[model samples]
Target: METFKIEGNVPLKGEITPQGAKNEALQILCAVLLTPEVVTINNIPDIIDVNKLISLLKNLGVKVTKIAKGSYTFQADAINMEYLESEAFKKEGSSLRGSIMIVGPLLARFGKGYIPKPGGDKIGRRRLDTHFEGLINLGAKFRYNKEDHFYGVESPRLKGATMLLDEASVTGTANIVMAAVLAEGKSAIYNAACEPYLQQLCKMLNRMGAKITGIGSNLLEIEGVTALNGCEHTILPDMIEIGSWIGLAAMTRSEITIKNVSWENLGVIPGTFRKLGITLEQKGDDIYIPAHTDGYEIQNYIDGSILTISDAPWPGFTPDLLSIVLVVATQARGSVLIHQKMFESRLFFVDKLIDMGAKIILCDPHRAVVIGHDFKSQLKATTMSSPDIRAGISLLIAALSAKGTSTIQNIEQIYRGYENIEERLKSLGAKIVSE
Candidate 1:
């Protein structure tokens, strides 16, 4: 129940480094269960969801040791399989969305994997069918308990098969890839998610002695191996956080430098922000966003139609940053339409921004049209509650650019993704305090 009291209308300056990819950390941590040897991981983000997964690993008897601030070593040699069936596990596993990933590595090494319906942001209907259906295609028997909303998968030995995914779900693809690496035969997955985080997982698995090809494409081929070995891996900087920083710089008229952003892997994020007329420079591996001293203007379509920003699979705009884009658009010089195709309820948070004096039209659950104030009309400060992780940060950015003090409740949602967000913002001269 933490609250953030942010003083608005202050410009931020300084350099901030993005945390390790949160999504990649989830998959890599689960991959540790695929081997009994020690696996070393670097650049781990100390966030709530990632930490919960690490704790779940410890409770399941994985030997975890802290090597440094953002590094850890994991060895799963003496896992207690019986712990998976306990009530404590059900409660603990249900608290994190990333917990669903553990089932794949567990099913690959052990004979069984069970999990309660994993919890996360209540943005929309996040179905588990993608994860379970992919596992079933890999020769695992699936069972469910409707009364308790629990799922279980078990197999004596998994034999790989060619399958086409219904959707390019990132976590689903990661789960299936983990299972297929140790399967008995060659496997081919078409229409797979090729996001950087998934690419990191596939590459890390290759380093650990699992054969996988098509690192950055939709078609993935895996040659089943008998077992995997431990390997050291480093996660990419979180692109979502980098995008957030870019939006924050634009909205608040701040000049900020984001260090070590993994530029080549950003995949259209920079281009998307540039379309909004924000000036960002590439200084080596860093992104330097100059203050929008005169405010920014959105680009219109070639045919003079309104600019539309929508979420698609990787290599396209990410859905996670659409919230930031919407918030940034509020202060731009022109109008743009934000279409959130993946989740229905994510755009609902726009109502809070509307209260802050942003001209927004919530067309439906999936789309919204925002007419930029162009800094002519500053958003009036207001009280709000964070609905989800991305929306929480979006609101925080809006609060920073608004005219007065704003109180945002339920900041715990913000901590689930961003690592030490308030402290990082404070270092950049953002007037934010958590209580």
Candidate 2:
């Protein structure tokens, strides 16, 4: 129920450190349930979703201890699998999309997994068909209560098999990989999502004695091990958060540097933003964003025209961040089209932008054409509520660049990903106060 009160038109300055990847941390936390060994994970973000997942893990009897501010040693030695059928489990499991991942490890370790329909941003129809299909191929028997939308999986001995995911879903790929790591035989996954988050999960599993090859490619071969041992690993810096900071700096004409950005893992993100004419300098592992004394220009196509930014699977522009990019495009000096093919309802926020005097054409539910007029900051600050994680960040960007003050309600949605966001932005000279 928290909200952010922001005084707009202030150029953010100073340096900020990126937090650990929320997506990666979720999978790693659940993977700990597969073994009783002490799993030491570093750089875990203090985000709402992670807190919720940790609470769920605790309820399942995992002994979680904080070794440092952002580090934890998880021991699932006494984890009780019966909690998977509890009402608390159902409520928490249905609260976040990442909860579905627990089904894989739980089923593999305990021979059964129960989960309710997972909830997340209502951008579009995010089906769990790929997840269930992959697990079924690995010898899992699924039972669903259609009336209640609850699902259960059981298999005495999960035997790995060849899995060709119908689509390259990020969470789906991670679920399959977790289940396959402890299965009975080698599992080959083709057409998988090879995002950095998934790669991080694979690496952690390997460190725990899981044999996984093709780390950065779609074709992954996982050799199921008899048991995985405890290992210490650090999560990667969140690329999406780095992208958000880049967009905020560009929109507010701020000079900021994001530290510890995994430069190599950020494929296509830098290039995608370069289309907006934002130049980034990489000094070792850090990214430097100069003060926008001169605003950015949108790049046009071949002979002379506006360009378009769209989303796809791995190695493509991340769908989760397209909303942030769209808001940034509004401040540019040219026209650009944003095609959100993955989510039909994501473009619904364009109405709010249009109300702020942004010239946007909602071509449909899946696309929007923004003609950047660089309007003299006519945005009249209004009271709005955040809808999702990425959209919430976009609204923050929009509010920060507006003419007057704006209040964004339901900031808990933003906190579900970004850690101490208001404090972080405040350190960068953003006039944002949370209450």
Candidate 3:
């Protein structure tokens, strides 16, 4: 229920380091249930989702110990799978979408798993049909009751099979991969999600004795193994945070350098920003954002038309970042269409931007065309609540670039991913305070 009060138009100038990815950390923590040996994970972000997953693991009797800051040692030697049926388990499991991932590991090791309806952003109908379908293809039996909203899975001995996912759901692909690695035969997953998080999960699995081919591509061929041992792994830096920082620097005309960015993992994101005329300089592993660069016109087709930026599954611009990109486009000198293909309701927040004096046309549930009015430093101060993690950060960027003071409520949403964000930005000279 905390709020962020910001005084706008203050240029940020300093260095910022992104924390480990939240999506990746969730998967890595779930993988701990796959083995009884001790495993150490470094660079884990301290976030709400991670804390919830840790709580779930401790409830299952996994020996989780924090060795140092941003590092933990986990021993699942005494995992009590019976806790999956408790009311406390159901409540915490249904609190976040990532909790569903525990089902795969639990079923793989203990032959049974129980989960309630999962919760997450209310952007749209995020179906678990693909997850259920993929797990079923891997020889897991699923039963659910709609009235009670409870779901259960059981597999005496999982037999691997070919799976063609209906949609490339990122977490679905990861859940299936985790289950498939321990099945009886070879499993091939076509149309899989190859995002950086999944890639890190696959790499960690391979290091733990799982034979997985196609590390960064959609077609994954996983050879089933009888058992997996523990291994130490370090998570990759968060790319969404990197993208948000890039957008933040551009909007505030601030000179900032993002340190230790995984330059190779940023697929198609840098080029996509270039289309909006933002140039980023990469010095080794760092990205430098120059100060006060004139916003350029958005590029169009050869025939001179308005460009449209849309989201796709993987190797495309992430749907999570479209909000930030749309907010950044408001200060550009041209018109562009922002299409959020994955989520139907994510574009609804643009009404807040429209209230701030930007010219935007909401074409439909999934599309909005933003025409830049060159309205530099003209946004009126307003009170708004944080809708989601990415959208909250996008609003913060908009607020920092506006003319007057803006108060954003529910800052815990932003803290779900970014670490010490207010202090980091404050070090960079941004006028942001939490009240």
Candidate 4:
């Protein structure tokens, strides 16, 4: 039971580097199972969820060697297929959502993949139908055992086929792509998730001798190759962490430089914060946020309607950053509506913001309206419990900009995504201690 004790009213100033993307790391790590050769990965973030996945891989007999601080080499030359049916696997695989991705590569290579019911943040109903159905469409047999709460996919051999996903599900697309990369023929995926995470995975696979085209679009073509070789991959910056830093600077009136951010891949995140009237300077691959001046203001629509900040698929705002946007809006000069379309319960965190002396209206399970205080009324720090990874970071931002010291409990939820968050923020002059 660790908590973060934060002293507010301090402007964080310094250059901080964003770690590798968590979502991408999950997919990339699972892709290692597709080949028996050594796969060297750079810029791996040392976080809880990812480490858990690494442990799961080791349990299945993958040899993972530490190359450096944030680099590792994984070789799956001696995998134990029988371990997938063991109780240890059920206990390990069910802990994180990323474990479900292993099923695709294993099922494609070994003809059988089993996973316990995966667990993750309680943001909303994250369904596994997308992954299972996609694999089934690729000629794999699927089954669900309600008594044991497990999912199984088996196929002696997979044949590629055209399939349209119900939605552009990220992990679902990754699973199907991994399976399709080694199937008998070409596979066309329509309405697929074209987020940078999936694109990087595809690019990495292509580097490892898999045939995949349409890197940055909804329509993807994967021609099944006989075998894939191991290759090195360097992950892009964590976009969610970049957004969090932007919100943190605006909330605390800090002048912080986020170094080496993948500018082109961020996709509307920097511009979205700029719409809130925050000053953003993009120099080369870095983003520099200047200290606050007359506070922040929300830009109105062209037709003079109340401004609304919402999340959509890629090339649109990400749902993961909506919580940070909502927290940032509370300190802006004008009002804006934050709509989280993908996840329902993510908006529930606004209640904690409202209790901190901010004006907020909870419209529904997925929407909230925030009237910016614009620093006229500084938020008073109070004790609160973090509900999820994004909300935890958002609350940490609020606590940093608050009037007094604040405490956030259940920090393990925060550590699941952000690596050494308190230590990193403290380096930027933030007064945060974990205990």
Highest lDDT: which candidate? 1
| lDDT accuracy of residue 273 in candidate 1 | 97
Candidate lDDT values, in order: 0.96, 0.89, 0.89, 0.94
TM-score of each: 0.99, 0.98, 0.98, 0.99
Candidate 2 per-residue C-alpha lDDT over 68-134 given as tens digits, one digit per residue, 9 for 90 to 100: 9889999999877778877878888899888899899988988888899998887889999999999
| Residue 180, candidate 1: alpha-carbon lDDT | 94
> Superposing every Cα of model 2 onto the true structure, what RMSD results?
1.2
For model 4, residues 140-218, the per-residue Cα lDDT tens digits are 9999999999999999999999999998899999999999999999999999999999999999999999999998999
Q: Candidate 3: which stretches are off by over 4 Å?
A: 375-377
- Model 2 residue runs over 4 Å out of place are 375-378
> Could you tell me how far off, in angstroms, the CA of residue 104 lies in candidate 3 after the best superposition?
0.8
Looking at candidate 3, the ten consecutive residues that score lowest on lDDT are 372-381
Tens digits of per-residue lDDT for model 3 on 335-381?
Answer: 99999999898888888888888888999999999987555546677
lDDT of 1 by residue, 60-179 (tens): 999999999999999999999999889999999999999999999999999789999999999999998888888899999999999988899999999998999999999999999999
lDDT for model 4 comes to 0.94
Off-target runs (Cα >4 Å) in candidate 4 are none
Error of 2 at 235 (Å): 0.4
